[model samples]
Target chain A: MDLENQKRVKDLTEEYGPENVVVLLGAAEGEASGIAAETVTAGDPTYAGPLTGVSLGLVVYHVCEDEVKEEFDPDVYDEQVSMMEMVLDIDEIAEEMQAIREEYTKY
Target chain B: MKGAGYILVHTPDMITHYGTTQTSERIVNPESEYLKNIEANLRPYERVRAYYPNQTYIGNITPLELKEIEGPWQDLECPVDERYGKYGEIMPQDEFYLLIQAVDEFELVFLEKSFVEATKPKLEQDPIITPYVLGRIKEGVESERIDDMVASEDAEGLYMGDKLVGAVKKAHAFDPNLSAHVMVENLVSKASSALALMYAVKNAGIDRDEVEYTIECSEEACGDMNQRGGGNFAKGIAEIAELSRSTGSDVRGFCAAPAHAVLVAAGLVKAGIFKTVAVVAGGSTAKLGMNGKDHVKKGLPILEDVLGGFAVIISENDGVNPELNTDVVGWHSVGTGSAPQNVIASLTTDALDKVGLKVTDVDYYSPEMQNPDITKPAGAGDVPTANLKMIGALAVRRGDIDRKELNAFVEKHGLPGYAPTQGHIPSGVPFMGHARDGILSGEMNRVMIVGKGSLFLGRMTNLFDGVSFLMEPNSGPKEEAAGVSTDEIRRIIAQSLRDFASGLVEAGE
Candidate 1:
């Protein structure tokens, strides 16, 4: 398990109360929707810094055109991680997210 | 009357070789834990005769081969499950594909037999071998016929054979729509299992017009979410069965569909309404290996594999067996209690009370409970075993049977083999085929096929779990005739009604 997903599990357990909930995530998406949006593995960048009793999730921006699809790099989806970083990285993360979002819209 | 005629079904062989197990704890698919539990608890038929060895194959449902969407999902993506906020994380179609993977899909678990054969050309023939026919062939000329069939130059001749042909003809005469062909299906997802069952029935030679009712018990889903079994399958299946619309149309119950279907068949038989009733189902393959990853990732033993399908034909003729405990009672953890505690006790006590069988009298109790050894450590909490214990506790509490008797009961029943953890399919139905035998043989009097579904997980509020039960044929009055021929009875009733109406009219005037 990735540190991130493993951490998310811990967080969800505490947040929902283990007895009341099981760890479930709608991981897949479709055009304008989540395709097979069933589940995601533990290490996906979607969850970060979740610990002890905190549940966390990442909202993906849909950049729906083919031309825009070319501009995205899977490796750079670091907003969740940056959110946990010291205050300094917030602007950079936010800026990058905006740029990525803007680029997808062009297509 | 043929004592509760038992139909023992095993997952199609091709399926086991390639099928996957549904691992989720929820009971969304009909083949979830509840269904599996009933299967596990049912007794096996000792007199084994394989019928309809040929499998029926349905059409392919392969998705339009995935194409990269012209644009990113953001432009085209549809609103998705809230839990997944937009992340241009993956391909749009993959998202839909994977989302379906998570739930207990009906089509993926059970496959149609002919579907399997359709995939493999060499196994071209689909045969429906009944118990009586299997017995006669086995005793009379199986080897010789096999040789003759093998010797035939044409595959059709081989399969449609002089011997096989005769048998098929005989079956066709009895049920003219009966196809001597066996049905099979390839694994896609669990829903195919249910589809396969429907496909089998329709393909088996039961004309759509002759079929007054089509009871579906298998867990395959014909519809996507929201639509719910709304597909051309009814048409596809009807075409396969060659049935027409006037014959009527409908499905019954939740997971206990097959059992419900049987009761319907029995009722039709008893009520003198319909003569032939067919219970058919297809399981999904999607649930396949749902838990394999959890086990493999955690380094534990793998629990379930491929999905399968089955179809049973119930008729009123003395040719088939009849179940006596028609007084079948079903209950769930409703009104009287809550989870963990009430769920167990209420369901058990209520079912037992109906037949006046103490925990001791019930040959076995089926609760689509999880297999403790396989599920306990996964934080599942040993639901099946706990269910058994609850039954014991109830018996002791009621002063019906003592603790020693409880131990004896468990000992006699034994923990069934580990089943797929899919909440519904694995529950009480898996062992039903076997338990049915004991009922027919008179070795066991009252056996209950119980099913329970947990609704809370689906996030569908206001819906509590549901439970249903079915009793197999046990002993009853020998030759307890129907009292009157159904046709004649209907005719007489019609005449009496006409006279009564005329008399009333005259009195009014």
Candidate 2:
């Protein structure tokens, strides 16, 4: 994640309280999605961004995950995200998000 | 007033075969997946020509045209035949390759005999290239000589359709900075900048001889080993463009260099140091495929395939063109925080405060105009939109706009990011040509150009850098200064006092 987004996540978590915030990531690759999920929850794994050592432990999910997908209107989801869904390796992305959530998501 | 010209050189071969990202990755991992996928993802010249954003870049179509056309521009059908635009042209790769050699003064670039013979005529036909420039393309060397250098002399091969058409030889035996790869990259920058400068002169209706000075603000640095960044890119570009009366120097500030150079140019003109100053920048080979991995991973076309170049000619305000407001310039000091909001405030409100103008008073705000198509797949988000939102948030904080009006403010003031992610090229400078026209035509009253740089990229400083200035319709020609010197005034005052004393003595007698 870029520094601006990192700052935004941190600010939003502080503003609304950690329990109310959830990050929906739309990265193409499992690893990138996982890294971003880890960044918001466990601080930046790369140790190079604003989130470093400031773990929010907020809830996070990849947009490809079933938990996030079910919340969207099916028609809207199909219209907006179905093409990307067809190309993505959802199982890998979901597994990464689940792993990060299991390890670090306190809220 | 400053006349801006911009061009995009579609160098797919350069992106795939020689871009620093690809070449560096190849050296580290020759069979990288991105490299393997490159050949399949490369867009043909025809598709590149028809891409909507590209059409806008070369001025073949207006930004408003995109609003009517449904896009994902890659999938949009835009049949454009003309490569030229109001600002400049979108040059194809083959002609650009010949230009790269044409601009070379060191004879370091060698082209295959057959390839040059075939491409020379096409290059000669471009109106931008004068006969003098066309004559600069060397009679081609034998293919064997180029191939042997690539195999034995560490020369970087230039390829077209898998055939080696040219090679750039290393300038030194052991100097990494003077290596063949670096030479090729610098030559590309020089060539593209020269082309843009030529267009700027042509578009502005100014004689080439009128360009008295040039400031090159590209990210590329040209020099030998002893002085790695010791640059005369401005002079090199001037030489190629044949700006006979111009002398120049380079200014480097990462992505913010163009804004800085433009301000510097404006100041020079305002100070009467130069009657006309062209601030020019060429594209970077390193930046060509900077985001390829992200695009390729997402099953998207490699949109960062084109190198971007721009030239802006700053002249004495003619009372008709938009005047660059040097008085209300913004600077991001070392003390300024690097937070997004802070940076935006520094660039927008801080400068606006000087002129007693509210954020809403400005007609448009152009920040980092990085094409979202390129940045979004790379996980950078919509950069221009993000910038506008920050500026909008700042407006809300200052009560210049209500919180509910933030979105509307953004919608009104923001422009879509259409520029290539060529670092300095996208940093609030790309829209200058449009802004000039909009102001001149009374469509816009004021537009601010903001440039932001990441100083941390150099590892020399943690401070962020930025500069901004407003462009508004010229108020009118400035009143000329009174001619009398202070010494002359003093002498006249003393003479009047003496006369008064003599008159008083005469009257008393």
Candidate 3:
């Protein structure tokens, strides 16, 4: 969400190539109770355990529910199981954050 | 003829989502290992990386890369894990649905009306499926139609859990000639084979029509009452892939079919019967989850969920692509005992000896490359490793290599097995795609593909079957023969006839 975090994601994407990047959203399974999103690319320091217990992370590619309806396999991401907040486009969000940082620095 | 393309489709749903369907029920008998261990095994993953997009599987990685990787490959860390190679991406479940839909040549397979509606957009988004195949998909069939068909036991519905995803209709109305069960098996084989054909066309950049002949060498049988195994899977797949000019027949030899088929294709080319011949095979649904119980018992996911398919082309000397060395071919003679040493010797050493080469002549050897991840848990041991060791032991017996060098021999000549145990799939053919690349790239030369089969399972014979062939770098342009014209041949025949007539006249005088 922050500019620094956006840069971190962008750097990771660049390392694995944008096409190789897969955005994973974790399910609330064990101890925790919220859908948490994480980005997986080629290089990462380590895996930050999911908010819940062991979770088979789901791929969250689309940003909106309307977009998901058209392109997503409901079997892969279900309302009963998957969390919505986990859907973040690292590339798109990173670009937006970069623009905001540029404007702020100009001021 | 110019090139080869290989594709592997992973049907994870067959393991997790479609487990309740009759197909699964048929495959998973009550006393079967998979069914008994369902409660213990980890849920199958939604996707696996090995069956990734074309770029990941075909374009990104070459056979050289796969061969170069040192064995006991699983120990290699991620991104590099034997499970996660550099080349292929693990295709998602939705993509597979789109693929099966794309390759549905006839109206036999119907996507559930609701599921079709739900997946249309995703299908549209698919990058690999041809526009023609994708365009054939229409609005879903309604629930009433699917329900009536299911209720009447007229159709077998494809499922992703309780929800209906698709259904396959029977080919015949009254005759058991085309029952729903036979129709489904044939369709799956056809669809998968067609996909392999499509990939061959894509990878080779050749028109489907250029494939003059096809040879289908899978373990599945497709025929009616009169002739059970009397089949035409090759033509069925050719029809689906729209190779109107190609005609073909099926080759059956249990697991050894692919190798035998390759030899057949090479011979055809060598004899100038066909300028271009493609050897292809589709996957078997019957073998799905075959080792699931063992995997589940070991707290592992069902590794045998993927159906494997491959297609390789053998054409006249292209001077570019690898050549199928016709001089050296291995066969398991009737007298060749079933001992491991004998089989390996006949398949490797004996064949090489004819060419004045030793067992170590081949830089790489591919023999029944069944993935250890799946086979080890099932107590079959590491099949590929065992095969390499057997070959090494044979080499030692021949004094071709030192007994102490057996491990090094295996390490040098054998590769980590990555093929599924889909009977014929785990045979030698899985490595052909890579072997072709390796030869062309000068990464290596003289790779041998050995296929072995159990004929006893057929109940008609107690014999074992196997055949092997070597693939090597092109020797350069073949010397062309100054061919005689038809007119010249006609003149020669006339002169010979005249001489015979003159001789008869002289004898009468």
Question: Model 3: DockQ against the native?
Answer: 0.01
Q: Which candidate tops TM-score?
A: 2
Q: Model 3, residue A6: what's the lDDT?
A: 40
lDDT of 3 at B507: 26
Model 2 C-alpha lDDT per residue in residues B26-94, reported as the tens digit of each score? 765677677887989988887777788887776666555554565557766577645777778889988
Which lDDT values do the candidates have, in the order given? 0.36, 0.83, 0.63
lDDT of 2: 0.83
Ranking by DockQ: 2, 1, 3
lDDT of 3 at B469: 92
DockQ of each: 0.02, 0.05, 0.01
Report the lDDT tens digits of candidate 3 across residue range B1-509.
35555555566656542333224434424355555455344333333442222212333444345556544333343242122122122344445565565655557777667677777776566444567677767677777777777668877766664566776777768657577656666666666777766766655545677788999999877666777677888987777677788999999999999999999999988898987788888777777777664466567767666666777777777555678898999999999866556677789888998979988888999999887766766646567777887788777767888878988998898877777777897798877776765676588889999999999888787888899999898786574212545574455345434533542353233
Model 3, runs deviating above 4 Å:
A1-107, B16-47, B50-106, B125-128, B173-177, B480-509
TM-score of chain B of each: 0.52, 0.92, 0.84
Window of ten residues with lowest summed lDDT in model 2 chain B: B500-509
Model 2 regions lying over 4 Å from their true place: A1-34, A37-99, A103-107, B67-71, B480-509
- Which sections of candidate 1 miss by over 4 Å? A1-107, B1-119, B125-211, B218-270, B298-303, B317-320, B369-383, B468-480, B483-509
Better of 1 and 2 by lDDT: 2
